[model samples]
Target: MRGDGSTPPRIPGPPVRGDGVEAIVAAGGLHNYQLELHAEYGPVVRFPLPGADLAVSVADPVLLEATAAINKRPEALFEFLTPLQESGNLQTLPAEEHIPWRRVMLSVLAGRPSHEAHFARFAELTSRTADRWADRAGDEPVELQKDLSELSLRMICEYALAGGLEPEEPGRVVAAFEDVLTEYLARLYQTDAPGTEDERRARAEEALTFLRATVDRVLAAYAERDDGPPERSDLVAALVAAGESPARIRDTVLMTLLAAHHTTGVAISWTLYLLARHPDAAERAAAEVDAVLGDRAAPDYGDLKRLTYLDMVLKEAMRLYPPGPYGAREATEDLTLGEYTVPAGTTIFYPFWAVHMNPEHWPDPEVFDPERFTPEASAGRHRLAYIPFGIGPRSCEGATLAMVEAELVLAMLLKRFRFRPAADRTITPIERFVLWAAEDIPMHLTPR
Candidate 1:
């Protein structure tokens, strides 16, 4: 109510019409659509989103604080993920169940012991990729997304499964996961590719079956182990210790693999892409990596803390191009967002990309400046102003691990080579599961 005792002005937006798909398409993609939406309307805008009848998008970090406690995700928006999980859709799991599930996940993924335990293998894997790139340094430009995503998958496979699989198993596991994602994400975005709809669905189902069976195999192996349960740092072991059902365990592994790989892969790729475009920052980051490693190929676990500038560069790159561009939460009850009162069950969209670009919080938001992340500069900033990982209770459990992986990969790559954008390719970010380069980021590498 206003001072005059009238109702508050309805949140502004374009007139609601047929499912908002056409408008999203016209604006290029969801990320861009969000940028345009908030630029035209105020920070809080009510708009029709395809999956939800109507959604309130809050770009203001302060307003976002009001919605941070929401743990319920809109089922309709996450329904596409249902096929992959038998236990339930992990994305929209009810809070009572989700709380315990997240605890098990964090026990393994967010712990320092887990990161340290995995560091050697992570470095080895990253070094192997660096060696491959070094061999082809001048041959042809390397596809950053293609290769890095695969590397990230391998690293996560090793981390999540705890090396129970045979050498041949990782390759097959990566392939199966790729098949599942390619089909499902296509369905979500309605992309037209080579296969018929039935064919794609069939293939995805087959791949999903293989993935679940693979998890079962790992579980069986764990059961047969004579040396008691594996360590807490191991994801599979942690879940089993918590007495999660086989179906939930499988779902957890699948979701962890799904979440970890693409996001970390694209994050490193975008950081490299941005550095390639901004030579000065690239040079500075490289110099830092060189100084920190000091004739070593990669940094040890402890050395990661020293690469401050490179960390800033990675952060700013994510600010410019967040891996998961947006997330949604269903208001559990009536909520006040700034001046607007949102009713229960309303879909509240967290446009992470837009929030990062909000000029009120981030002045000259689009500029590729790493200094904005400096302690002095970041001092009084809103906490939610830079959520590369989504917000609050349902936020990614692997956030800590991801940073370690990305920084490790970036440190080694920057130490080994200087990357330059491929002359013939144009880099454009398109939303597919994760924010992906429409044409994979092609870069020519020069050995340092």
Candidate 2:
């Protein structure tokens, strides 16, 4: 808003012939659209989203402080995800409800006991995947995103289910999970018509049923285990212990699997892609991993903290290509940011990638420099300048788990192999609920 309590400058975007609707659609995706908008209109740009609603995109880290503690997400933007939840939408759950729900999630996801309990199994799955890649023909091309996505799905499934799933079950579960997301995303993106949508929803319904049944089987097995739920907690056991309803528990598990499948995998893929392109950085990461886990195939949970350079490389990759490109919050009350004010109910877009690229915060923002995250260089940076996981109370709860999973997998793979971009390939970053390669990230892997 202006000084006299008027609206802020109408952002300089494509003319409002259709409220900038056509232009937004033409700009490809919100990822590219926000990039173009911020470059032209400066840090704050108001642009049209899915429903022709004007949203303010804030790229400046200092300006973002006005919204750092907002706990509310925009209802309209998050409604698309409600269909996945029968009880309610996790993304748009009311603050009263979200607070407790987030607490439950954090306890399970961020718990050190949970990480310790699952670390061996997670490492085994990662080594198995890496060994398979090592066995492939030297010249055979690998789609890093596709392969890592499957591995991540299996890893998260085991972590969430806590050994309830049979060894053969993950492949089928991964297929069903992918099916459900594919159908829903088609509708969420408006890429399908009424008839096509109906069929897709039907398929999604079937896939959801399959997923719920699988979870039920796991829960039953978990209940019947002779060891009595093991010493460590998983998501299902924690939710069950909390006395959450069956539907609610199922929804939470489904949501976790849905959330984990792409994010952890994509983060690893991007990190590997970046490392492969920067051999000096890759060598440094490899050296650190080798030093930390000499003669071992994978790292012990305690070794994670010792692999410092690998952490920096992974953090730098996310800085360049965050798993999710943007996150939004709705103002519950009037707010002032810089010279402008935002009215209650206004949707404030946090374009994370743009925030990361702000010239004011990052000198040579386009360069992939891992040293940017070294403790000395990082100490002076604004806290929100590098929000790959997002901000506020609604930020990702699995951040600790994600970092552990990513660093361990990078250690396991980089210790045993060298990766290079496949010839004639380039990565185009696009938003699809998360930032993803417009095409699969193709690469060549050679055993060390």
Candidate 3:
């Protein structure tokens, strides 16, 4: 086990075929690769990345505390985002810059005032999507991811832009954003060749231009409006009031959209999937919403706090299928994690899915059980045991916002419709910036 500060055992994976790149590929991407390594080699496993040095994977919550305060991220790992940032990629910003930027973000994103201000629009956007679903015939499958992604995009645009985007704006923004991401993700996987790479780059450029132009229009409209509060709650307004440049504000809005898009949608999708598969939990969640909302079509901001069971269900769902599966941190100083001492500059991979699956923390980890998050059951557990949104400084800035959105959407849908897993459908979870199903998560919705 090498408990004496020496390097942890290297995963004896598939004969190491040249820096273990081939082995990692064969293991089915980094998410599955880490799961296999942790299961076989224990909490901390050393493995080689294709073009990098040995990386350490940490699954044990206790060990995570040692690196919890790390402020640096592996630049190479986050290079995929460079194109989106002109000042700097948010993921790899230096601590001095990151702290202030994060402070500004948290001021708006994590504030109760900001959430309350946006809750009405969030509910409105959700209702619009649900209204479309209501029009579908019974037994028709709803494409959970696609529908919810658009819903999330709408919610974020409304929140970021202040008065909400035009009725036709979301579709164009969503399409352009997806076009940009499709090519960026392809490059991340090293799948683009010179010829195709150029094409992808061109497409990405066009899409980015469209997105920036859209943001410019929104900002221009904001400038021309007189209805904003003396103290701004909208992110763009807040950023501008703080004296940030137009380009910086635009980048911030785009980054927030990108972060919230698939993550919030997939989170809602997974929560629905889990609740559908576990009707008892779904019923309890619905009952809680009913009791709390009481004839109200959707929950008000204050009502969110009172929906306890819904909170537990969402937490448990995230434990099982975190929106973003994993994160990495670079050690700035030598640190000892349990019995092992890791050197500075080492890239420590926090495999959050594995951490959530640790039997020591979660009994029958794969089983969908909302009770796992009940206040009683959750007490005294490792703080890092459930890190779906990650931990420390680099955690999702909009986490509170994401949760508010998820709970509101879940309550509305479950209150009006019953979600049932479509028969004969298979869901394959893959890492696509976030953990997402390779195919749409199809579910039948019947009126409750």
lDDT top scorer: 1
Pairs with steric clashes in candidate 2: 1-341
Could you report the Cα RMSD, in angstroms, for every candidate shown?
1.8, 2.3, 2.6
Q: Give TM per candidate.
A: 0.96, 0.93, 0.93
Off by over 4 Å in 3: 1-21, 50-52, 192-195, 228-232
**Candidate 2 per-residue lDDT over residues 101-124, each given as its tens digit:** 889889989999989889999999
List model 1 lDDT by residue over 1-448, tens digit each: 6667977667888888776777888887888899999999989999888778899999999999999999999998988788889999999999999999899898888999999999999999999899999999999999998889878888998898766667666667666777777886566656565588898888888988887887788778767778765776788878878899988988888888878888999999999999999999999999998888998998999999999999999999999999999999999998888778899999999999999999999999889999999999899898999999998999999999999999999999999899999988778888777898998999999998
Which portions of model 1 miss their true places by more than 4 Å? 1-5, 164-179, 186-193, 227-229
User: Candidate 3 on 310-333: residue-level lDDT in tens?
Assistant: 999999999999999999989999
What local lDDT score does residue 412 receive in model 3, on the 0 to 100 scale?
96
So what's the TM-score on candidate 3? 0.93
Q: Any idea what lDDT model 2 has? A: 0.83
Q: Candidate 3: which pairs clash?
A: none
Error of 1 at 129 (Å): 0.7
Ranking of all candidate structures by their lDDT, best first: 1, 3, 2
Off by over 4 Å in 2: 1-14, 17-21, 166-169, 192-198, 229-232
